[model samples]
Target: MFRVSLLFLILGFTCLSCKSEDKNNVGTTEENIDALLQARYTKLLNYDVDSTAFPRSYSPEKKQIKQVPSKDWTSGFFAGNLWQIYKLTGDSRFKQRAKQWTAFLEKEKFNGRTHDMGFKVFCSFGNGLSVEDNQNFKDVIVKSAKTLSTRFNENIGSIRSWDFGKDRWQFPVIIDNMMNLELLFEATKISGDSSFHKIAVKHANTTLKNHFRPDGSTWHVLDYDTISGQVRGRVTHQGINDDSSWARGQGWAINGYTMAYRYTKDKKYLDRATATADYFIHHKNLPEDGIPYWDFSHPDIPNVSRDVSAGAIVASGLVELYKYTKNDTYLNYSKKVVNSLKTEHYILPKDLEVPFILDHSFGDWSKRHEMDEPIVYGDYYFLQTLLRLKEID
Candidate 1:
C-alpha cells in the first residue's frame, strides 16, 4: 500500500485545466508555477493551524493534518517554502507569511539533540536572509552552524547523525547528513572561519569513502567506531531493506553534492553528483513519468507507490546541477519532471484539496511508516525546484 494517490490530484483540482507546459511562456514558467503554489498556500493559511505547530504532512484519505514542533527536522521546510514564494512572486504577503512561520524556528538555533540544524535553521533563516539583510538571521545561522559543529567527531571525521540509536549505533551518519554540510560551507564564507569548511569537507570525504556503493547508489546509514575511525556497519534503517536504494537517499546525494559543488567549485563534488544523477536517470525501476518508486529495489517495482518527493528533490537538484555544468541533460530531464509532476495525479488539484501542495511523499517505508502522504520537505523541494528555474534556469 505504498501511496501518493492520483485520486486527489486529478479528481478535484482547479489548476489541472491549466496547460502543463507553455513552451512559448518559457519566460513565464515561473509565473505559472508561482500562481499555482500561491493558491495552494492560501488554503494552508486558512487552515486551523497553531502556526508554531508547523504543518508537517496531511493525509488526503483520512483528511488529517500532521504538525510538529520546531525541533522536528522538517520544521524549516514550511518556512523555506514561504521564503521561496516571496522570492519568486515578490509578493509582500508571501514575505510576511514567510517571516511569521520562520520566526517560530529561531529558538532552534540552540537545539543540539540532532544534526539537522541545517534543515531547521538554515532553510528557514538562510532563506530569510536571502530575501533581505537580517543581522538576527545571520547570528542565528552562525550559531546554528556552531551548534551543528559540536556533533562533529574529529576522531571519526564526521558528524554524529543520530542520538537515540546509541545501543544500535555507536556513531551513526546517514547520507541525508550530507545536507548539513551545505549550511556549514555557507557559515565559513560568512564567518571567515575555515574550521567550519574543514569540518564540512572532512565529513563529506568520510561519507564519500563509506556511504556510496560501486554503482553510485548510497546506503542510508553507516555507523563508525570513533576511536578507530572505521565504519562499524552500513544499513538502511528507513528504507525497504538493508540492501535497497531508498528513493530519497538518492535524491539527497543528487541535491546535496550539487550544493557542495556550488559552494566549493570542486569538480569532485560535481562528479559525485553526476554519478548519482546518472544512476537515478538510468535505474530500471524509474517510472516513465519521471517519479520513482519508494525504493528503486522495491520487491515489486511498478506495484509500489511513487515518492513524488524524491522526484522533486532530483528535479530541483538537476536544475542547480544544470546551472553548474551547463549540461542540457540535467535541464531537459528536470523540465520533463516538472511537466510530469504538473499533472493532477501528483500536485494537489487545487488549494481547496489540502493545505500541502504535492502528495505521495514517502518519509519511510520501514517501521514508523510515512508512505503515500504529503510531506513538508516534498513541498519545499518542489517549490524550490520551481524557484531555481525562476532564477537561473
Candidate 2:
C-alpha cells in the first residue's frame, strides 16, 4: 500500500513538472520575441532622420552639403512614422527630432501646400506631435490644420490640389488627401471648433464616393469641377492612370482608411481598408521577394522597379488591421512582408554606414528611375511596424 501511494505521488509530481516546463518554454519564446523587437526598434530610432529641414527626405549619401532644396509629401509621411515609433518605444531622441521637423513645417514656406498635406503634416505634426502634447507643437499643428481647412471648397466638398501654374483646378482632390483629414480632426479637437470636423467628414465622404473603385483599388488623382461640384476625371499623375492601380497609392488608401476607422469606428472605412488589402495580397504581380512593383498594371515594363516604401506602408496597415479584426491571416501577411524586407534588400544587417532599410527606392518616375536610393517613408514604416509588433508580442 505504501509503495502504491509513493508511485502515485511521483506520477503526480512528474505531470506538474511537465506543465511547468511548458509554461517556461512559452515565456522564453515571448521574451526572445520581445528582445528581437527591442533591438530592431533601437536600430530604427538610431537611423532615419530629416537631414535638412529644406528637403525632408532620407539622405544616406552625403552628396549635397546644402540641404536638398525640395519639398515632397512623402517625407512628411516618414517623419510621422518615426513619431509613432517613438511613441511606442518611449525614445526621447525620436520625439525631439519629430518636434524639430514639425517646427520646420511651421515655416511660411510649407504651411498651406496641397499635394499631400496629410502625408506631410498630419503624419509628422498631427500624429507625431500630438502624443507629446507640447503646446508649441500643438500651436504649429493647429495653424497648419487651419491652413488645410481653408483649402476646402464648399462647392466640391474637397480640398484642392497643388497650386501649379494655373488656377484651372479649383477643387482637385487626390486620393492621398484622405490621410490629411486627421489634421482637421485634430484641429477640431484641440480648438473646440466643429467646422474642422465637418470639413474633414465631408472630404472623407467625397473621397468614398469618387476615389475608390468597385474592386477597392483607388485612383491616384481626382479632378473636380469646382463650378459644377462634380468629379471631372480620375487620373494618375505619377501612376499608370485611373484604370490602373499604383502600388503606393493603394498603400496610402489602406493606411488612410484603417486610420479613418480607428478614429470614427465606421464600418465602411474598415471594409474598404480590408478590400484594398485583399487586392494587394492577391495581386499577381508581387515579386519573388514579396515586395511589389511600383504599379501593379505596369508589370510589362522592363526592369520594373520595386517600391519598398509601398511594402512597408502596407505592412504597417495590415498589422493595424490585425489588431482590430484579430485575424491571424493579416498578421502573417504583415510578418511575411516585413521579413522579406529584413532579409532581402533594404535592411542593413548591422554596423552599416547608412541608417535605412531598402536601398535604391524610387521617389517618382519623372526623375531618379533605376537608381537604388533610400526613401524616408520606407524607413519610417519599417520602424513603425517593428515597434507595433513589439507591442503586440
lDDT of 2: 0.65
- Where does candidate 1 clash, by residue pair? 3-372, 4-360, 9-344, 13-349
RMSD of each: 5.9, 11.9
Please name the candidate that would achieve the greatest TM-score relative to the true structure. 1
Reference-based lDDT, each prediction: 0.81, 0.65
lDDT of 2 by residue, 54-173 (tens): 332444465421233225555565456557756765667667766665555555224666645556666676665558666766676677777777788888888887677255454567
Candidate 1 runs further than 4 Å off: 1-37, 47-51, 351-353
**Model 1 accuracy (lDDT, Cα):** 0.81
What CA RMSD would candidate 1 show? 5.9
Clashing pairs in 2: 346-358, 360-372, 360-373, 361-373
Which lDDT tens digits does candidate 1 get at residues 163-190? 9878998999999999889889888888
